[model samples]
Target: MGVIRLPSQSRLLCFAFHIIFILFQQTTAERELKFVVVVFRHGDRTPVVNFPTDLHKESEWPQGFGQLTKTGMQQLYELGQYMRKRYSNFLNSTYKRQEFYIQSTDYDRTIMSAQSCLSGLFPPTSSQTWNPELPWQPIPVHIVTKSSDRRLHFPLHDCPRFDELQNETQTSSEFQNRIQPYKDFLQTMAVNTGLELNNLRTLDNFQLWNTYDTLYCEGIHNYTLPVWATKDVMDKMEKLAELSLLSLFGLYETEEKSRLQGGVLMNTILKSIKQAVNSSRERKMEVYSAHDTTIGALQIALNIFNGKLPPYAACQFFELYQESSGRYSIEMHYRNDTSKDPYLLTLPGCTSSCPLEKFAELVSPMIAENWSKECGKKDKKKDIFIGFDVAVGLLFIFDLVLLYLLYHYGRCRRRNNYQDL
Candidate 1:
């Protein structure tokens, strides 16, 4: 070592070589991010449905109810630009047909959000530019009509079993206990909002939330809220809303509900992940623009939901990676708050970087073999009746056979007696 120290140039070269070797090892050990699935709520919008008495009526909103506002457009646009920067190391500088996909819930707010987001992510460049003045190019946002879209939407309608489950949930001890304290407050809501809650359905926690949302949005947008609408009331409404959503998706028989609703989406996602891996597909990303319920439902299905509403433009990511050992792994991240990077979430039974095979196996139970069938397209009552009828028919056939055998024995005994006489 003392002899080597005599040559400064040689020592410097040796140090650089050691540093390069370490860097090379680290690079080779790093896993490669192969694909990603990004799902997000639509940005802020006019209330979905508002009370009749509210000052910010349907006419007050530019594109009517449930439409995206300028603020919403800006939110998605910024998010798109952020994504472009975030994935610059992975994604190409310009848009490619097979690199990514965008889908929405056939709603103006969500569809527009996707378009606005794409504008920022893939601004037209070089040959891609049609007009010199416009930086945007068309990106197709796919959708299935709402009624047929249980996979992306939530509180999935037309599911009789889910409806039955919800009814059961309301009667659950947990629901009764949680709602007992809020009964008076909700009655006050019924009075102040001028909405008549005559039945159990009308007395829903979700309804109270909508009423609060309307007034709150109005107040924020310069329209005066009702004098009765106070911060305390809003907070209470928000909690009730969260509870309503929870009660719907869980709080009783969580797994069954997940199989009926959230499982559908999760199954689709897992399929895409597997296909990308096995078929060596070029699909690098799949971006889904959906409602808050969609995000919540998916989280619930994965058993990773944090028991709160996912805020506006809240996003969840499922990323796939191939390790140096040639094995694949899945990782999940959630970005609900703007102030911080996405939090890495671990699957209940598996590590955050769970193997692809293990991830699929762990989640297989949640995936419904038939979503519609599980949701009660096949009648349970009919099946019971059919079984009952079959049992009765079998019993009748056995009795008939017994009666015939007894008659034959009697006839044989009479013939023997006559012959003896």
Candidate 2:
């Protein structure tokens, strides 16, 4: 037993290593991601709708029209893997039903994309698999039939008020200003492409979007476009398509329009975030596999859009955290480009890590107290009821006036009679 002591330099080295280890442990033990809500457009797929002149008809696609392509599946698979790496600390490494959830629009492409994405996100391992040969596991993707769906899908249909809003938007000074410069080009496109266009103003949002999508899909698949689809025409169509997107709930009373459309989804997302914070083990993450419109609507609702269509598989992530100060906050990120890390998105009125309550307050105007009422689905009934009440009030006032006139006439007659007497 020798009284051996380490050299002074060695003692200092040991002390430094101990301190570094403690700091690393503390950093891990202290910081935690409490909740996550990730919403993403479905991966690349066949165009949802196409023009009559298009060479790629509905039958030309693998599953006919609007089906997910193999390329689309791969894209979502890659996206899921990216999510796994990005949230390795927050989410469990293994597939755990209690830790995660997923949903998608009620479309073949979206539903399949959800499955493909989940395959990459939670590859089956050990007892989680039913068959050793298959690396996939069945994960439920919640969705309502298109007819009943309201919250997850964007540019919701059957909302006549939203349609009226669009009518006004197309007539706005800003809308005219943006589209005025493209008047000649739009006419040229209609003439050349045989796309029936009565006038520049008649280029409705869906029509513009449809043209752009056809050209875009054709270009990507290396299909030969007609001579009419020149670069200039395509460029203008792209601009018009962008404008069409803005026309959707972004122009004129943007907040109120959002409350009736994207805000429904936002509320659902926030609800999940709040729930996750309250119970950590119950749910760790929520994923929505939808369309480009879904992402666009959400971006505008969050007031963070960058003025372009979100590309295929684009995603918006809502990450929740509990700070050491005992307060909860939200962090948002957009992942449109796979080459780089997702960019952090800050609410225009708040910091990147906005407090949860503050985020709710700032976004409250966009969330509808009653979605159907906001969409004016019951406007006719409401109008009739109001009209009836107003009519009743007017009748009562008219009766009062008639009675007063009668009383005045009787008083004058009685006074005259007395005077004559």
Candidate 3:
């Protein structure tokens, strides 16, 4: 056969096409989503608790404090619809217990938020329809009582080391420096908000956060702010609230604090990811209905916190993808605003799409193998035995000393009697 020489332009075009083909393949390979885990805060609602001096009362809300309002339900429902649209191809048209799971913190708002979201996520089809009047089907939203739910709760009160860490965070130079300039302003807030200065600064209860929340909620609902809560004052209070939130899980020995607070939840997520990767089951989604603190703790642990309180219905997504090359990677996205798309959250020390193995390694330190032990909790039974042993030894030493004293007194008496005789 006669050899045909291609024109120079044709040769360049062929090389360009080859490069484009390779790039397209790589892009396609990376886009195969395998599984997703969503952690979302409960939708907008009445404040969980009121401040001492507040204009709004529980009776003012449609439901009492901390309950989901109609608006809150609609927010979650829209979130569900968004999710359904986003993952249309990945999930079944109808809800399958084997493929999808949802969990919520044990609270009226969260449980109801989960339910409301499910209503939009899996509206009944003709086959699933029990009643023609209602398009919603009851889907289970699993929950453990707040006392027992360690996975979704943040700033666990049972962890002693975490408590100690908070104490240290307060004393740390970084925290002190951060709050130093705000000292006079905090005192001013204390006077205006009817809270003790010490209480406002304390990180345990996040009193500053509560103050900000009440004001923020009232403003959201069109209630007039307290005269003291001017725009500038609210702005300052907001900054302190953000600082208070950050101080709960960081600002001193962040890794150790995360191990106790956020790490627990992260460990659960990592385990779920691994199971999805290894298992043959078709489980594709896990949804967590929780609080701002829950999202904050998790983000802090991952070193990706945006330094602001997560708004109502804010969501963090951990999506697992199996590339065409057979390797899995994780991509994280955060949706804090309904008006815009979720922000891509890149894990520190890794790219936005990090290899599964590397992501695990980076987060391994925060996961607690023994949560109780790491919390510096001693075994109660062991402590009791140790106390008993110490008490018995001390009693035996006391008995010996008493016996020696008695014997010595007896000898002295005998010698005196002999001299008298």
Local distance difference test scores for all models: 0.84, 0.83, 0.90
Residue-level lDDT tens digits of model 3 in 1-421:
9999999999999999999999998879667888999999988888777777887788887778888878889999999999999999999999999999999998999999999899989999979999999989999989998899889977787878888888888889989998888888988887887788897766448678887888888888888888888999888888888898888888789999988989999999999999999989989999999999899999999999999989888999999999777899999999999999999999999999999999999999998889999999989999999999999999999999999999999999999999999
Model 2 misplacement above 4 A: 1-29, 198-202, 279-281, 379-421
lDDT of 1 by residue, 203-239 (tens): 3546666776677667767787887888898888778
- lDDT preference between candidates 2 and 3, better one: 3
TM-score of 2: 0.83
TM-score of each: 0.83, 0.83, 0.88
Predict model 1's lDDT versus the native.
0.84
Q: After superposition, how far is residue 198 of candidate 1 from its true place, in Å?
A: 5.3
lDDT, residue 348, candidate 1: 93
Question: Every model's Cα RMSD, please?
Answer: 6.2, 5.7, 4.7
Which residue pairs clash within candidate 2?
none
Error of 2 at 224 (Å): 1.2
Q: How far is candidate 2 from the true structure (C-alpha RMSD, Å)?
A: 5.7
Between candidates 2 and 3, which one is better according to TM-score?
3
lDDT of 1 at 242: 79
Worst 10 contiguous positions by lDDT, candidate 2: 196-205
lDDT for 358 (candidate 1): 93
